[model samples]
Target chain A: MLPRRIYQFFLIYLLGILVLLSLKYGLQLSDYVIPGPKTLWQTALEVFPRYALDVWNTLQVALIGQVMSIVLALAIGIPGRSTTWFGNFIKAAAYNVQAYPIVAIAPIIFILLGDGFLSRLLIAAMICYFPILLTVLGVMSEPVADVEHFYRCTGRMRWQLEVKIRAFENLHKLTTVIAGSATLAMAGTIVAEFIAANAGIGYSIRIALYQSDLARILVALLLIGICLSVYQGLLEHTGSLVKKAWTGSA
Target chain B: MNGKTGKRNSLLAAAWILIVLTLAVAGAPEGRAWAGTLNYRLKWIYNASVIGDLYASGKGYFRAAGLEVKVRPGGPERDALRELELGYADFGVASADQVIRAVAKGAPLVVVAQLFQVNPLQWLYRTGKGMIRKLDDLKGRTIGITYGKNDEIIMRTLLAKAGIGRGQVEFYSVRLDYTPFLRGKVDLWPVYANTQAVFLRDKLSRAGEETALFVPGDFGVRFVANSVVTSEKLFKRNPELVKRFVGALLAGWKAALDVKHQKEALAILRQVDRDTPLRILKTQLEITRRLVMPRSGPPLGTIDFEGWRQTERIMLEQGQIKAPVKILSCLKPML
Candidate 1:
């Protein structure tokens, strides 16, 4: 029997061919000329190098956004969870903000913060922040009566206790939050770049669409997929390292 | 902890503190001094109409009227009236026929002004492709048209004129793929004569591709395709703004026609149109100039009332519109 990976690849390839066939013959469709077979080949050759660069840009934005989100989420979650007075209000506000559509928010962000790396970063951070915040808040809120009692008996200062016990103890939760936020941040960056952009994958997609060239559009999408896969791999590697360190130390 | 660890921790803590401080300081809403910004959702991509917006901006006509037009280049996914209805755009340019559809559907949009006096819809093919001189020649031949109600109505009318029934001709959705006809995949394709045809012939001359164009006007089908428009409610509220905008845009259109400025305008068009060729661009410019400056009374940039009536008659006959539209009511007289 063929290897499972090869089998799956074959299946996917067959399905793609079927789709192309349907678009061509099944619907009795008239194939468009501009981005037809010849144009597709031309674009495929021209776009490969540029596509690699765009993917790099996308990855860089996503990374910065993910890191910012994790930091902001931790800062918000820790104090908001520990404090009683504004805890519910802060959590509700965060949730409400998370509910706003990325597409609707992108234009406002673009206007308020001009098209810079910082603006796109902020959009990515905003989109990714909620998942990390919620996850960190949930993890921190988990009952740790024994640890609280130990800290109380030791008469440790709040800052010292938080650093040694709370922060160090929740490494897994933080890593998971970072991983999830990184994925969301990538999505947000794409949305932000789609509006008021001069470069990046989203801008390329927009240009392709205006010219009504489907090949470049598909190529852009393919490049994005590759970029996301690489990012996910990095996230998983970092996550596993963190997990290993935490486990080994214990 | 080591001295290095202490320094790194202090830097991180300071950064966090700085972020919080910045957030607090930036939370206050700034006063709206830039309130005169007019968001315009264009009907299509960076084409002639989009260049018109650029020209209008460059000439400071919009600023002279105390407005800053933000021209948002639109696509197939965008709904211009929907953008206007949602207050995303102050006004937009779209088909006069769309105005009838919008009004019938209870959409609060009205025609504020007209742009093109004649629609540029045409059936283009490579010459000597199986006797395609008349409409009946389209019978049993593969025809390329967009899969829209309006396109269908236009094709059906043209087919009927050629003494061909619906079943005789095969309707294939072109989806703006201009090359399929050149590749011999289909016999005929509908195109915007000013835009697509120019791109095909002029832009790709070096590529050695050839095309022959047949227009709907030549076939006794005449309609105005694009018009400057605003919401009915917005029109009632800010009639002066609409008037100023129309005047400014007319000025922009006039500037586009100037022989001296045509090169500058073409340069801007070329910058935006990476795919279109120089031949196509010049062809579009000439064709558009002819249509806009038809050899008749009221030199150029004038909407024909009879043209609107003819469009409505065709649309109504084809069941594209429910009720008859009054052409005079649709016209916003140039002040």
Candidate 2:
């Protein structure tokens, strides 16, 4: 699965670069507009070590943020799953909070938190939280009536048991949602870095853009794609491991 | 259920294909012209700095020249030089760094006019916190600069010129907000002398704080700022149109910056820059005149050949560009 994910990313990234190169040669665009292959390769060699470290720093923040969001989503989703007034209020608030664009709120976050790890973590968590929250809410609220009815009738069903049963029944869905949110978490971190933070691949890309070096930007994008692919693959692999361990499957 | 899943996947695949096709079509470059139409892109957003470009379009100066020019606003993200090469724009305003960098990369870009003879990008410092009377005064100062922006290059050059190492001063990364500067976390903050400087100086004064500007040009860091640029093809293919367009554009600038035309210029600026109060806008225009056209300087939109060479040399020395672009050859002053 990890190899496939990495391979797919390479395919798509190369295709995109191919299209850009086609545009460059077709329209006779200079390296300034879309860098030639030699320039791009040379830039990759020049900036790889620095950008690699930047990507790793970004991934660390994104990992912590994703964990926080997952915890936060579950904490809220479990409580907000019921059809009570408070539950509806919680749902409404979450929906409304997600409506505010993160880009618009990022400046405020950076101003209050400073452009450090905290700001990037909050932004990543905020962006990665909403989708996970919605999914968790949807999954937890849903009932496995056949199995749940038997548990309730036998007086064996507690709130914890109910959540476990629902989550167990929709294990594939929960796994998929968690794995998919890795992209959002990474993207959120990059956006945070691009907007304010002085470190990370996004900041490097911003510097490249300032210099109008498309070659450097292309190299940065290549590094981001590879790191993101591996991270997302790891998330999916971990999700599958949890499922196998829970079910005691082969 | 299987059929439904297949249908959904098919829809997703179709959507992806449509997106790819749309991207390909949009990315293809062609000199899009209709009825002698022209598109002129700016280096930055609609502000006092672009009074001439705005006035040219607002006052129908282009229309009088039998050209339907669309005067587009620009931002930091906008690359007018790239647009010119892409055929998305017939003419554009690019910084000297952008032009030099582009030329070094073999981009067929030519500068037809230099808008600001004196680079307006200056550092704003609060008065009580000590003055930057000389380059060494910048030592130990927490200077604010946008890392990838022209400000960083200029600041680095300034520091080098002062024989100051990076360790001497705290380099603060500037963003959209000036909170750090306001809260006294940073000392000298970069601002456009005409636009942002005017606004920031006013805000400081109202809060009972005196402020002053530190212009790099005064200290002999004559990095060129904005200039009118065009593709070599357009400049060569249609010299007549280029001449008329630049002529009319400069005329608009001449009129707008003229003391006699201040009333009319303010009225024109008011339409686009509604957020800036008339009082602030008036002061901005006044400051712009000194930078753009001094008493002994060449006419409005005049290309300063010596300054262009100096700008290229600075970039070479700083290693911003790997090689000299022979920037003078690119300066084809239309007038």
Best by lDDT: 2
- Report the lDDT of model 1 for residue A190: 77
Please provide, for model 1 over A1-250, each residue's C-alpha lDDT reduced to its tens digit, 9 standing for 90 to 100.
1244344444444444344543334222222311345545676798879977986887788889888888888778876676577877777778888898866666566556755677778888888888888877877676466887787788874754654466566777777667666668878777666654456676667655543445677667666765665666677677877778867742
Give Cα distance to truth, residue B5, candidate 1, Å: 50
Residue range B1-335, candidate 2, lDDT tens digits:
59999899878866775687568757687765434678899998888999988888888888998889999989878899998998888899988988999999989988998899899999999989787788989888899999877888888888898899979999999987888888889999999999989988999999999999999988888888999999999888888888998998998898899999899999989988899999999999999999899888888788888888888888888788887778898899887
In model 1, how large is the Cα lDDT of residue A165? Answer: 66
What pairs collide in candidate 2? none
Report the lDDT tens digits of candidate 1 across residue range B28-104: 22322225787777788888645666678777878887777887787777757756664567778777666665554
Measured by C-alpha RMSD in angstroms, how accurate is candidate 1? 20.0
TM-score of each: 0.51, 0.94
Using TM-score as the measure, the top candidate is: 2
**Model 1 spans > 4 angstroms off:** A1-250, B1-35, B130-133, B202-210, B274-279, B297-299, B325-328
Query: lDDT score of model 2?
Result: 0.88
> lDDT (0-100) at residue A117 of candidate 1?
79
TM-score of chain B of each: 0.81, 0.91
